[model samples]
Target: MKMIIATLAAVVLMTTSTVAFAEQFEVINTEGSSVPGCQVTNSCFIPHTLTISVGDEVIWKNADVATHTVTSGTQRGGPDGVFNVSPFFPEDAFSHIFDEPGEYPYYCLVHPWMKGLVIVQDAMADDDNAETTPPPDDGDQKSQMDEQRATPTYDAEHFVTTWIISTPGESIIIPTGELTGTYSVDWGDGTITTEAGNAIHEYDDAGNYTVQVYGDFTSIRLGGDPTNAVKLHSIDQWGMIQWTTMESAFRGASNMVYGATDVPDLSNVTDMSHMFAHAHSFNGDISTWDVSSITDMSSMFASATSFNQPLESWNISSVTAANGMFRGASLFNQPIDSWNTSSFMDTSFMFLDAVSFNQPLDSWDVSSVTEMSYMFTHATSFNQPLDSWDVSSVISTSSMFWFAESFNQPLDSWDVSSVIDMERMFESAHSFDQDLSEWHIIPDGT
Candidate 1:
């Protein structure tokens, strides 16, 4: 009979121990009861520092009839909107699960003096059953909050479109739609559809127009159509493909298009070369482009007459070759001092007919240059300092400053001993006044 009593007492003790270990933590007032307010003697239940294993949960019960709150520290503050609570009220409870191992401090929003600490131990200590309880609504609320912090707004009044054409003239409204259906011509009176399925617009006068295209339109090849001379205005936030070399790659003629008169939103473009070649009237600001992914800018603004945007801020430091990059451009006068030309090899005629460029270029590292013939022949006003340039690897200087009519600077420091040609180095330069006593040998043996 005594043994039976002892066995029953042991079983009861074990059951009580199991129940206590199952609950991670419980917060009650000083009285130690499950009631809202603490004991009369101790009004507050202070759990200053708590050390729990990963996946452990902590529950805060409103021991006092007054309202209270639980707010995590700034470092691990969960969501921006739900970071605070009100007065300590009755039956108010807040709970949080510690899934990550870290030191998290929290406090009551209503009473700054009330604080708590939670230290979550690493899960590796107890490998088994470390999974935390998922939130009641899963993670839907957190996901929505993250997305709301990301999207940008749009503007309509500041948007404009400018087009460049092959022929000299005509006016027309470009219809916006998926690249399908018969092409139509808008002459301000009525719309006329063509049998060739090509939208034909006529502009008898010479001016610019701001065209608007609404909705989702894709596969658009701007300035590729032979009879089209329109340049889409600002790209704003839209995605568009401006130019191409292949005729069949777009809906218009490949070679007939001349220029791009609009500022394309190249925020989405990975390449920007040859997008404005043969364009004569494209003069817009492109100094703020993010061209980090562009690998080929071969003839980007070649022959563009009015393109004078500064590109000194671009990360063209990775460009390896700049062959004919700005061959016939006439109005590009921005400084190229910020360019990293260490990887560049081909700079032949880079500024061939660029007449408006007279900035100082003494800092350019041309150590890898092998050709300089005709590079500055027609550049009339470009007589800056070229004394410090290393032309040791140069093989040709034939017509370098031939037609440069305003070149009167000294070239005594230039090493032309290894140059194979100096044919017309001073052809039409009527303003030649600098002494050539230091010149190794005149091409005509003068």
Candidate 2:
């Protein structure tokens, strides 16, 4: 299923930013490492000792629940000037470029027991047996003495991808079988006009390159390698790509964030599920995006911890599924009560764990919604008047405000005639002591 979506997106898929010559590697601060047990098991940083070639990039991903740092030096000696990452939270990442060759040791300053080492080797050494030549000017410039690197074969399995150009003479396979519509590819170095299948150009030098494709297509897999983005940095263009296939285009590109002033054309788009889910550092001002045609918005900004833009001008009249749209978006707190949701439904998990969200929602027309499960669970700051909302159409309000520590409002006028399940709807909501003596519950069996 992933490959199919990737292939469809391959038609207009273009990786914008230029990557480095050396390959990228990931080091994870493994799950359940915040406690003391991980240090005893030597499982603090997965592969506590990582060996890589010079010029390679190492991305440290925090998969643990607690915040951590990737600081250089030992516990006693303190931090060396190697590479130090400030406090980064779970699902967030920090990358460092390694240019010099050496044995660099690092540890978490907050947790001294968590230790790791990076061994950088000079991969392009001037050997006695190999001959070297100047890099050809046709492609990216190759580093001196980088001659013995083997050519990378293109994989047919991956139909859609944002490439990280490592070695020269590598083949970039574009599925000519798909892409019936017109599109163009700017392969960073230059543009490729011809729609060739596998006979794509190979660089004469051993450096790096990037690409951007724009055309009409079915769908594109959300960018990055599922959960992590290697070289995805920016979206410089949206081109003339005409389609609703931009679903999950930048789902997990943690590196693509901020200073994004370019507003994309979304007139042709409809479904936008998981569009920016887990894009940790993205805080681009897209408050004016034309999202009127959009319908499904499930998980669009889920886990996008840095996104906090105004959405008051958005026309959500056509939207339906809004479940998990702002789940885990801790910094998002904007007034969007003015959005028209007359045709909307399914508001489950809309603000789950959105800790900083505290806005007025009494004006929202939620009369058409059917499922309102977990709508404000863990939204610690959400406390507003919801008695004005007409929830007669809602069938499930399960876990709606669970753990919302600050929510305390009147709900005497709410209609629960159609509700079937209200299980744990107000559990752990510390300040919620609303009287519901006038309300009546309708069981499913009835």
Per-residue lDDT of 375 in model 2 = 95
Model 2 worst lDDT run, 10 consecutive residues: 1-10
Off by over 4 Å in 1: 1-226, 229-271, 293-296, 435-446
Give the poorly placed runs of model 2, Cα more than 4 Å off. Answer: 1-182, 190-210, 215-219, 227-229, 258-260, 443-445
The TM-scores of all predictions, comma-separated, are 0.45, 0.60
Q: Could you give candidate 1's per-residue lDDT for residues 268-355 as a string of tens digits?
A: 4444455666554344456666565455565567776546767888876555456556767777778887676655555656667877
- Candidate 2 residue lDDT tens string, 1-446: 00000111111111211134467788989987877878887789988999998867777778888866676765434455455544445776756656679998988755668998989998764475246543364144232212212222232221223343335665444333232355555565665564432225555533224455644333444453553343344443443445454567678876453322345567877878888888775666678778888998889999987678788999878899899999999889889999898887999999999998999999999999999999999999998888999999999999999999999999988889999899999999999988998898755627
Candidate with maximal TM-score:
2
lDDT for position 139 in model 1: 64
- Candidate 1 global Cα RMSD: 23.8
Q: Poorest 10 consecutive residues of model 1 by lDDT? A: 1-10
